[model samples]
Every structure is written in C-alpha cells, then in structure tokens.
Target: MPEEKQQTPPGSETEMNVKPDHGEQSYVGHGRLQGKATLITGADSGIGRAVALAFAREGADVLISYLNEHEDARETERLVREAGRKAVLVAGDLADPAHCRSLVDQAVQAFGKLDVVVNNAAFQMSHESIEDIPDEEWNRTFAVNISAMFHICKAAVKHMKPGGSIINTSSVNSDKPSPQLLAYATTKGAIANFSAGLAQSLAEKGIRVNSVAPGPIWTPLIPATLPPEKVATFGQETPMKRPGQPAELAPVYVLLASDEASYISGARYAVTGGTPIL
Candidate 1:
C-alpha cells in the first residue's frame, strides 16, 4: 500500500495506484449459477465487481447498480459480456428509496425475472470524534448501507421465486467496531442484525438471506475514506499481515448465491484474513 494514496468519495478502480484483483484472469466457472437473473449494487468496483464477474462466469445475467462511476461500471459490464453473459448498467444513488426499488424493477425487466440480489453498496468516512460526524452523513450511511437493502429486497422478493438468494454486505466492523468509523460501523452492526431477522422471515418463502462480513480488502474504499497514513498501514492488524483482495472474497459470494448452499441461510460469512468475527 502506498502512503500517499487517496481519492474522492465513491472512488474509481481506474484511478487506483495498484489495481485490486477482481479474479479477472484466475476465475474459471462451471455454470454454477446457470441462467440466473441477478442484481448487484456497487457492482462498479471492489467486492461488487468481483462478484459480478464471478456470477457472469457462473452463467448469470447481471444488472449492475452503481453510484456515479461510469468508467468502472463499464469495465465491469465488459467483463460480464466477455464471459458470454448479459450485463445492464444502472447508475444512481442507492441512498434514495425510490432508486433502490427501481433497481430491482429494472433487473426484472431486463432478465424477465430476478433470482439473486447482492446488497453490497456502502458509504463510509473517518472521523476522530462523534462531534466531527455530520447528521446528514450519518443518515446517508444508514440510507445507502441498510435502508437500500430493505427497499430493494421488498421489491425484489415479489419478483423472485423459490430458491432465490439475497446476500448483504456487512463488515468486520459489525463485530469489531472501529472508533474512527463510528457512523459506518454502527450501520454495519445494524446490517448483520437485519440480515439475521430477514433470513428467518424469508425462510418460509424459500428465499435464503445471508450476510458477508469482509475485513480490510484492497479496494478503492481504503484510500477514499481513510487518511494516507492509515491507508499505508491498512490491514496490518490482520493476522495475515496484508489486506485481502476483492478476488479472495468472490468465491464466498458465489457459494451463497449458488443452489449448492440451498440449506444455508441466516449466517454471516467472514472474510477477515484470520480475524475471528465473534
């Protein structure tokens, strides 16, 4: 990690110093998600991009929901198409409830049905004190991180049939809070709880719901939110002594989305580089 790396909010992968590996060259699929219709928020970069790539190769048509990173989103769309799958790009703010619902509708419209939903988009900022956090920033974090997931699921479940899967992106912060990321960490905790409760409620409908809690991964979000000094030493605290790549987290998401995990739900899968979630 470089000491002088930083970026504006909602960062771009094209602008990264050392690009994160999205399993572009290494991932080989066997049609695990064959003919599935999927929608993924934040698919423009980071874990979202990696998941989109994996799903595409696994035979799923993807609807990519991103913020404003057109270049990054286009790159992801290219990867999906390259894998011989359909990819639709939809750019908007996930903080809006209306936009969240619209994303599911668009995916259903594009593929004629929706089978999987990955609520992975999130916003975070570093603050030394609670007083330094803005009321709007706090509200915005919850809106994009957890509220959007709820709204999207509400709309998607109607279109999804049995065997559908909903995967939410929780964080290591959900279990191990980071003081500087107070607002972001708070919402992550809420996401874990929300996923748990939602999973139980959706069980009767045969819709599996689960959450993935990722530790420090080498993504644009690192430089975008943390200071340069902190970014340089990012992931040092992990037992692996390095940050996990986006590609490393992809297989977990792929498994959850596939029918192989039909009996698994209401669980939190942690990709924390040996850091325990509990």
Candidate 2:
C-alpha cells in the first residue's frame, strides 16, 4: 500500500491513500436502536459514519457533527435518510467549548430529545521527539480529544433521560502508550477515566457511559496524522497485521447504544483486532 503524507492537519478522507470502508453495503441493523435519537461527532467518515449508518438502519434519527467535511458528511446523511431516518448535519470545530455546546443544542433542537451521544471525534499527530511537538499542538490535541467530550457531555446530559447512553472513543494506545503519539495516547487515557467516573456519577440518572478502545483502524486520520513512511505500513505491527475497517466497529457501537447494555456501564470495550488492551 502507498500513502501520501497529508500537508494539512486532520487530513481529508477524499485524499487518503486508501479511502476507509464505512459499511455502506454490509451493515445490517436489527432494530436495536428503534425510535432512538443519536448525536455522533466525526460522523463524516470512518467509525463515526459507520455508526450513524447502523443507528439509522436500526431505526434511530441521527444528528452528525463534523469539522468541515461537507461532502463526506452529506454521504453519511444520505445513508441515514436512505434508512428512512432523519439526518441533521452540523459542521464546526468541536475543540471550541462554545461549538461543543452548540452541537448539543443543535441535536436537541432537531431531535427534540437525545438518547445516545457518541463522542468519536478526535485529533492526533506523530512526532519523533517531544522537542518536535509544539505547545499549541499539544493543547489542540487535548482540546479536541478530551476537553470537547467533557464540554459536550456536560451540555448533553441535561436533555437525556433514563436509559440514555454515551459512548466515548478511546484507543488501544491507552493501554500501551506510543511515545510517538504521546498527546493522543494521553487523551485516550483521560477519556477512559472520564467514562468510568461519569458512569458512576450518572447511575442515578440511569445513563450508561462507556468508552471504545480501538487499535489501528484504516481511517483518514491515519495518513493525515502520520508521516508517509509510517502510513505505508500502518497496522502491520498488530497481530492481525491488518487494520480493522470502520464497519467492523459499528456492531459494538450499536450494542453499546441499545438498551440491551442497560447493565453495562463504566467499562472500556477494546476492539483492537488481535491486541489485548489489558
């Protein structure tokens, strides 16, 4: 596989070495999320987009949030609409606290209520040395990865009722920190802790909070954030020796969002192909 390192930060899916597989044709929903309303960040592509498709197929209306991937976001909306569910697209930088709050408000305004929130948007970059990482880059990573989740969750909990669910996107890096991904790995650890603590705190409200720790998945974020050399061999180090597709994660997300997970909270679910998170 060949990869062209992206010149811009947070690379676009359209310019990827290999565009991610979002399960447009394969994912089948079993009405697990019937009549539910969901808000998913990063729903323009990758795991978030796949989750939106599955949720809609399972009979949930989705409100998608993305930075500025209008074309990709529109395709996600089309998939949701094709499933006979409502799709609302909101574009902005979630790194901003006000924008994070606005996403919650938009979801509430569009759906009237929120049943599920998937904080799946994130930012990452690879650097050889700490000296190579800038102060603003470190802050931006935290702001988009963990702080945005905190801000959005704070605003979203108010509109959610009993049996609502919140799923945060963590990473296998949390268990095995990658020195090259210091900032991203750190934020993932925080996300896991946040989910566990919030789950306990929200027990009275009956809102289940959990995190999904994924290994190397073939998403646009990979090529965009990594050096060209690393991108070409991405995920080859994993036991599976291949990156898991975005569609492969949709089922786990669907299960977490469904009421069937009523008793499953405060847990970190690892979807790292052949890697063990513990």
Candidate 3:
C-alpha cells in the first residue's frame, strides 16, 4: 500500500486524510478507575482524548485542558458526559506558566481533589536544519512541552492525596532523537527524566509519577507538524511498518492512572509498536 498524506494546522482529526481512531467503541472499562478525579492536558484529541474517554468509562470524571480546539474539546466532553462522568473543558495555551497553574486550580475546583494528572499536551515542528530552527521556536517548544509539566505538577501535587498518580507523555524521539525534530526530541528526553525523578520525590507521599513513550501513533500531530512527504511514511521506519492508532495507547494509560500500578513508578512504558526505546 502506498502512503497517503494530508495536512492541517493545529491539526484536526476531521480534516485528516486518515482519521485517528481513539478507542471510541472498542474500549470497555472494568471499573479500574472508579470514583477518581483526573486532570489531563491535551485532552481535546489523540492520546489525551482517548485517555479521557477511557478514564470516564472506568468511573472517573475528567478535566480536559486543550489549546483553542473548542469543537474537538466539546466532542471529548460530550463523550465523557455520555459515559456518566463529569467533564470540564479548559481551553488556553499551556506555554504560559500562569495558564498551567490555573488549569490545575480549575480541575481541583471542578472535582474538589486531583487524583490523576496526565501532562500529555505538547508541541513540535520539523526542521531540515538546526540553523533553520529559530530560537523562539525552541523556547516555545520547551515552555509548552516540559515547562508546563513542572508548573502543572507543582500546583496539582498540592491538591493530590495519598495514592495520587502523575503521568507524563514522552515520545520515541526521546531515546532515538530525530535530526529533524531536534528541539522536540530534547524536550521529550527531559520529560522522561522528569517523570522518573518526580516519582522518587513523591514516593514518600504515596504518590506515583511515570511516563508513556509512544512511537508513531496516528494522531493529528503527525500531519500538523511534519511535512506532507514525511507524514506519508510517518511510522514506516519502525518494525511495525505502520502507525499505531490512538486507541491502542489507552490501555497503558488506564493502567498507569489506576491503582493497579501501585508499585509502578519512575518507569517509562514504551508503546512503540516494536521500536526499542533503550
């Protein structure tokens, strides 16, 4: 099969040539997350949206934070509400430190307590050369990708109780840095380290911190960030020879956010569809 590609800025799944599947009907929860309150950044689409649906179906209310993707965010909220769980949508730029902290406050205000936090929102752009990468872009990437995590976690941890969980979204680029995504890759590496280090720091409080490293998943970010040519063969370099659907990543997130992983902290679980992260 030949690779087909399409592009949309601030990526929209509806506009994507290959619409990303986010476990809409395939996921069935067994009450693993019953009665939990969660705050998920990037919950408007892709992995974040999938996680929100999975969590809600498993008996959790989710606070979804996204950046000006209202239509998509509303859909996510509808799905969560349909599952009989509360869903609150907070739209703003995560690159702003004040917005990051305010979101944590919004979630606590909505749900009264924060049981889970998924720092999954991120930004990236493909550059042919480092010289082409503007300094402002690099700083923006770091601010949104890693710096926002620090602010959100710092604020949310205060409202987190014993047994709370924090999940960060790293990427396959963290281990296998892509020359084209130099800035984004560097931030991913930082995420992996931050998740592990924060895990140990929070261990005494009965809280857990972990990271999920996904390979080329069929999400809007691919088309939105990568060029059309690169997007065509986006995940073909991996042994899987294809991209993973967003739905496939939900189970791992559910496990990490649940009490089932009580002993699983400071670890980076890779769903690379056969790419070795080590």
Candidate 4:
C-alpha cells in the first residue's frame, strides 16, 4: 500500500484527522500564569498550541497569531476557552513587518496589556546543501523566523510594563547543526544571539528575554516538513529514542512567562530530551 500524503505549510491539527495527544486531558495548572495577557505566534498547532493551552490553564488570556491554519487556530481557541480563559485568533503572514506590528497591537487591544510575547512561528524546508536552497526560501525563512521577532519585540515592549517576559522559540539546531537544515539552523542561532542582546537592553525595564530550544517533538510540522521515512524516525536519533510530546515543553513556557522566572533572562533553556548542549 502506498503511504498517505502529508499536509504541507502551516499544517492544521484539525485536518490531521487523528487527534494529536496534546495531553490536554492530563495537563494540570496551578495558576502560575494567572491574570497575564500573552501574545503567542504560531499558536495554531504544535509547540505553540501546547503553550497556548498551558498558559490558558494557568489563568492567562492568550492571543494566538498564526499563519493561515483556521481549523487548528479555532481548535486552539476552543481548548483555551474550555480551560476557562479567553483566546483570540489572529491569522496573517508574519513575514510581513506590518503584520508583525499588528499582532502586538491586536493582542494589547483585546487584553488591555501584553505581559508576555512568545515568538514561536517559523518555517523550514529541508535542503541537502546551501546550493540547493533557493534564494527566496532563505529570505522567507529569515523574515518569519528572525525579522518578525524583532518587529514583534519592538511593538510589544511599548505596551508591556515592568516584569514582562519575551520568549523566543529557538531550536536545538541553533547549537547542533544538521546539514539539511543549514538556513533554518542559521535563523535559530540568530534567535539565540538576538534574545541575548534584547535581554541586556530590556533589563533596565525589568523585562526578561530568553529562549526555549527544543530538540524534537511530535507536531504537525514533522509530517509536513520531513520525508515519511524521516518522520518515522523523528526523535529516535535523539538520546531518548522517541519524539517528545508537546505537553512536555509546556511547563517551560509557564515557568518562563511567570514571575517565578523574574530573575531569569538572557538564558537558553534546552529541552532537548537529554541531548547535551554544552
């Protein structure tokens, strides 16, 4: 039998047909993020959706800015509301600077204040070598992955008060390079340095900036971006021998966004399933 075709680009959780085990049924919160207003890009699915639901469960109203996955975005909103918190879905391309600015504006307008900004949206196309990567693809990757973060941070900081948190979704690739993801890895590395620089600049304002570098987790992006054979062995190459679940990374977002992490800034948290990043 032939293998089923996978969905591509900004993949949808709803169209996934088989529900991803988001651990929604098992995830519990103790109000670590209560009463906060958070803006999370790419919250329509994957790690973003997990973080959105986790934030909501902890009593934070979330604004999810995604590409164009309406079904996944709606499901995220529904689950957030079920957790007894408000969720707003804003769909647009983050590669545009104007749209990046609007994402911050809309979040603040809806929630009255933006306490946390999670720059989580990103795209990657595998290429065997630098020569194989099209110029357009390289530019698009950087625009969405790095440039949008700059735009959102600049806009979000205007509305954010002291104690604000900025969490960028970096990847383990930032430190460990996979030849196939050269351009994508470059962006992640840039994110790490960007987060560090921003942290220093924002320290005087009491705003903490940091990043979470995930190794591999089961999300729609896996099937959409990787070959089927590669997808089957997704996290097996990792020391853990299995891909992580989204829920596994949600708590890190909670800790970083809350006052509990007030003194933590300019740090990169490695949630890479035992992959050492020294």
If scored against the real structure, what TM-score would every candidate get?
A: 0.99, 0.98, 0.97, 0.96
Candidate that would win on TM-score: 1
**Candidate 2: worst 10 consecutive residues by lDDT?**
2-11
Using lDDT as the measure, the top candidate is 1
Tens-place lDDT per residue, model 1, 1-278, is 55545799878888888899999999999999999999999999999999999999999999999999999999999999999999999999998899999999899889999999999999999999999999999999989998999999999999989899999999999999999999999999999999999999999999999999999998888889998888888889999999999999999999999999999999999999999997
Q: What's the distance in Å from true for residue 90, model 1?
A: 0.1
> What TM-score quantifies how close candidate 1 is to the native fold?
0.99
Off by over 4 Å in 1: none
Two-way lDDT contest, 1 vs 4, winner: 1
| Order of models, best TM-score first | 1, 2, 3, 4
Checking candidate 4 for backbone clashes, the offending pairs are none
Candidate 1 lowest-lDDT run of ten: 1-10
lDDT per residue for candidate 4 within 1-278, as digits (tens), equals 12425778656666554455665898898999999999999999889999999999999999999998888899899989999998999999999999999998898889999999999999987877799899999999999999999999999998989999999999899999788888889999999999999999999999999999999887788678777777766788888887788888899999999999989999999999899874
Q: Candidate 3 lDDT, tens digit per residue, 1-278?
A: 24545555558666666678888979998999999999999999999999999999999999999998888899899989999999999999999999999998898889888999999999999999999999999999999999999999999888998889999999998899999999999999999999999999999999999999999998888888888788777789989898898899999999999999999999999999899988
What stretches of model 3 exceed 4 Å from their correct place?
Answer: 1-8
Tens-digit per-residue lDDT, 115-204, candidate 2: 999999999999889999999999999999999999999999999999999999999988999999999999999999999999999999
Write down the lDDT of every candidate, Cα atoms only. Answer: 0.94, 0.92, 0.91, 0.89
Q: Rank the candidates by lDDT, best first.
A: 1, 2, 3, 4
Give residue 226's error in model 2 in angstroms.
Answer: 0.4
Q: All candidates: CA RMSD in angstroms? A: 0.7, 1.1, 1.3, 1.7
Q: Which ten residues in a row have the lowest lDDT in candidate 4?
A: 1-10
Clashes of each: 0, 0, 0, 0
